[model samples]
Target: MTATVGALAPISRAACVGGGVIGGGWIARFLLAGIDVKVFDPHPAAQRIVAEVLANAERAYGMLTGAPLPKRGRLTFCASVAEAVADAQWVQESVPERLDLKRRVLAEIDAGAPAEALIGSSTSGLKPSDLQAGLAHPGRLFVAHPYNPVYLLPLVEIVGGAATTPETIARAKAVLDAIGMKGVVIAREIEAFVGDRLLEALWREALWLIKDDICDVETLDDVIRYSFGLRWAQMGLFQTYRIAGGEAGMRHFLAQFGPCLQWPWTRLTDVVDLDDALVEKIGGQSDAQAAGLSIRELERIRDENLVGIVQALKAGQGGEGWGAGRLLKEFEQRLWAQAGGGAPAPDPTAPLELLEIRVSPAWIDYNGHMTEHRYLQVFGDTSDALLRLIGVDFAYVEAGHSYYTVETHLRHLGEARLGEALTCTTQVLAVDDKRLHLFHRLFAGPERREIATAEYMMLHVDSRAGRSAPAPEHVLAKLRAIADAHAKLETPAAVGRAIGQKTRLAAPV
Candidate 1:
């Protein structure tokens, strides 16, 4: 579990301390987002914790991918915190929320981690100032608080203390961004931070309501579940209230609430802490209401609800923290210095297209098997080899001419799995001035048994013309040789697709 920096850096490995809910949550989020994770938790249930967290993460990622996740980033469970932190660029500590425990972990992390690495404590209430008191490099330590189910939630509040540096914050932000997270930086570090402070204020008011017999816990939840809570899902307080005032907006709402600020209303302070008895009562009531639903079920409901709300906001076609519909325009142009996006596939008959390809771990799909699309891609590779030999260069196409696949017939004969070596061979079946017929066969590399076969009809095209055209002289000559050689043998039925309208038409029919 004590992996070297070299091993994790290639894939951007992160370290998580404590395999409890929060630690496990961090591991799941990072790993599922294609970041390798090294975990250290003394609890015997660490592996199970990781497995369950992975399962949850996988489910969440599945929603995004619309299929099983691609080969996920690797996961490593460490024997100790030092081993986990040894080479990690980002170390997230989720030990018990006790100040001494955090102080000890941060101190140990500072000793083991690289001087430039960021060490974040996932404490909901403890201030970064208190946590950094015992650290050797206090600047590297900060609060990286995440809401529950970090895998699904995109928001992370980054609170840095007096000793924390701007560079450290930027480094942490870069890592989060790479993992598809949106981070908001707290201007200044404070106890309970922003999110927790807001939640605590609500909790304090809710407690007062329950204690004074104003409303039951479920009823208070209903008020939130139905009214402002619904609006808050997409927009926060000020924005929601601004909309409530119509044309008057924020200035109007502020002017209205400004007068009520001094009036005695609900308490937002923590003077009435919920002691153990109250905590137990609330826990019992929650269990009574939700005992029928499993934790996994609850997570599903939560994620689905979030996705619906966020997607709705996104549909509104506005900017963040406002209407959902934001117009996103994407522009991309590839400089065609050469003709193609990739090197031509190795030829099977000639030295050019023939290649000994080793199957990588990424080739497998959600079924824990090689996917059909990859086989097609490999065949496409073979076609590229055939075209390159005949002078169908990428530059030629960019200049206005290209080859288009009119038809392809493919068959999977045997299963190909990960770590398998495979061989692909492409042979020309027929050729004319404007079209080339080709077939490709894939075989298991070691045993030399055929695994898949494909036959395709390739049509010469003037991409600039958007129609078929005759091959250039040099290109036609290469196609002639391959086609002439294949004509000696019996061609497969799939390779005999009918030729379309050729390039020499004087006028439209």
Candidate 2:
């Protein structure tokens, strides 16, 4: 059964095959952020593959917000292909690089998948036309090629065949957008798509040079990386040339070098083929350079660089990285993420103070949970803020040089994790010339869950003598009025079993 478009039916979950590098990356990208995932791979290490994916996902998700992720999504491991794609709205197939293997997998997905579901082949070479050759419905099948470490990189190439519809492309774009990815639509289905085709052409030429003994491996790599690769990172071939040529532009540069195209210069594509000896040479050189570093070590280095570079770009644009920035803006409009109305407008008389205060990382402990000490510290800050409203503020404490924490206690209720914002509300309880008692309840932000509470007896005193002193007449009168008004007001349920001599539990006993 299908739901109407845009009807807030549950999130469109995905299924992936061949839980290797590419499949693992997809799971990391989607499932960690509360999107469901299903995987089917005959390999025995499929579970390990997904666990690695989840680990990478946790890292990526942690970078997005100062606080923890909303909620983890569901992931199911299916024993067979049919079970994985049974009701999945999207399926990503990443089996071995064999035409027959892909054709069979597509056939299985076509048979069991819903008619509206979109199926993508993560093949680096096979064209969409060839992959969908024997499919039951070729229209739903397309090449949704993703780069390695797909969760970190935002670019996805969507190559469609003759049967593909505009609506299908639109839906694919929406899915990519939801997960903070940029989808580029390739107008026609071509072999090896854009990025791969460009790299393959370069590879063919590099192989030819090494085979002919014209240059060494390191030399060729250095030439490209130090020269053209630097420019290409920010701009493509066409645009880079346009800038180089200046006002004369690409036409001028092409006119100068167009004749060189006919010269027997380099046969990167048609001229040189991947013979065995050349492959061995390249492999030996690669191993020599790589030495003995584990994949995990390499991945950590890669993530650090990606984070740094992307963060720089995002910083330039005021916090929206290239792909994620677009999604972050759109996410703000989502109802669940936004603050709703009818929160009993702020009371200006007893004004809820502290415009804003951020909870820091240091407040967390070795268990990776928020330390209990911080709970009282934040509530104390809130109480101090409320005290300022009635005139028993810093000036009073500084002049007297003494303040009392007479009755201070906290109920250890729920746990708060690292980087979580802890907030508290102070409601005036009772006030006298000598003692001002206040009640405060602390809550974890974002979810608005209650964490702890503090009932304090603040004494105003003289700084020179460190002895209890009555507050001034004006401050005393204002405190009395506030306490009188709030005396009839109710307290929240977080206040456990009446503390000291106070009994203002808002709810029924």
Candidate 3:
């Protein structure tokens, strides 16, 4: 069966024609999205290079989110482009940036790949029209330029050639969306596309500054990273500048800074010469900036930082997420929704196993065990799982009625170390029209033993009204079914016990 997240149907098979840096990244992203990939690259070290890239992608994905990723797709290294693209549903070409080379390779792919297969080129600056010139099925090809570390970055410029049909562009975009990527179709193809154009402008200015000894590479990087770069990550260029307009808005802001556009300070129109002396100065400063870290080490550090930033964004805007983080939130919602709908029936006599989690490295403390607040987080998530099980979902909450946890009692029984698998079982203690009583046990580590327990008192409320209220009968009925079934089990010893109550496992570890 094809593995799918959310309700999006993923492309079943993909052919990646080049396995260099960008190629490998494309391959990893597709495979992680549960699409089998066939790869063809003639470079002797291509396999090893792709393997390393895949390892990093996996580590990054593990830290990125706790949502259940679909099962990984099978990877096969093929000898020829024909073998790889013979029957693939999608084809990606990541060959080096030479128009002639790309056309030659795409010709073979065009002949061997299924006529209807979606094909994309990873050319940073080349136009899709130039690359499509020699293909028999030119309408199937487009430029899908992505940034470095394609797996983590969400943006992919989808620029169609003159010969490319609208249907092909739409299909390409659909596949990108299904794989949790953002594909912005450029209205018209240009030499360097949108992102690279902006980047090249900045690079030109930076080069001129270095050539004139205005600032070292390190200093230039620090200035950008410490200020506007942060804003750019969450909000793009125009949006950031719009805020600069202040209360007056973009028109006023543009009028304020518009005069600066003609200033002589910028050398954007002039190209900086990369003479030997200038190259040496820039290269030496870059070496010092690296501070002795290897390329792979720097990549890992960058990946970790990107993961944290995106995760924080996902928790931003009051948990509604912002920008790309919002997309992640929506994607995770779909994953959870699909999983919930397809889950098997729970054993009525036992506590409902509502959630399972992997302890991410980000959650570890100096003690190297799961940290203090994460316990509360786990139990809170467990409660959320129960709430979702009983119909307090996004729509229910959106309607302005929800079960609010009024009280929580947590008993941390033992340590939960890093990378451990954990699960939570919740037993409903009592249910009423306006209140809910629940007991939750958390199992940690490979053994999945009981490591913690939480008891909660939730009050149903009309959030818009700011008062307690009865939940709809539909919700109450499901609650009644579970609470009645749980009534058969003996009450937990800690059910009503306050903090500091004596028990065999109560003493501090």
Give the number of the best model, judged by TM-score.
3
In angstroms, the error of model 1 at 448 is: 29
By TM-score: ranked, best first: 3, 1, 2
Stretches of model 3 off by over 4 angstroms after superposition? 1-7, 275-280, 344-374, 389-392, 395-402, 412-436, 441-452, 459-494, 502-509
Expressed as tens digits, the lDDT of each residue in 1-509 for candidate 2 is 00111212234578988789888888777764456789899999889877976675565444332222324557889989999999899889988888899999999998988898989888988888888888888998888889877877777899987777788788888787666677899988888889899888888888888888898788898898789876675566999988887799999989987898999877854767667887898888776766676677667556645554453444445655434444443443331221112112336355243322334444556887777886776777576555555555445556664446777767767888643555566777777777877777667768868777777777877768867887778877877777776766776454445553375558776
**lDDT for predicted candidate 3 compared with the true structure:** 0.87
Q: How well is each residue in 128-150 modelled by candidate 1, as lDDT tens digits? A: 98888967899888889987778
Task: Give residue 409's lDDT in candidate 2 (0 to 100).
Answer: 62
TM per model? 0.63, 0.63, 0.85
Q: Per lDDT, what order, best first?
A: 3, 1, 2
Which candidate model has the greater lDDT, 1 or 3?
Answer: 3
RMSD of 3: 4.3
Ranked by TM-score, the better of candidates 1 and 2 is 1
Candidate 2 Cα deviation (angstroms), residue 26: 1.3
lDDT accuracy of residue 328 in candidate 1: 10
List lDDT for all candidates, in order.
Answer: 0.69, 0.69, 0.87
For model 1 the TM-score comes to 0.63
Candidate RMSDs in Å, in order, are 10.5, 14.1, 4.3
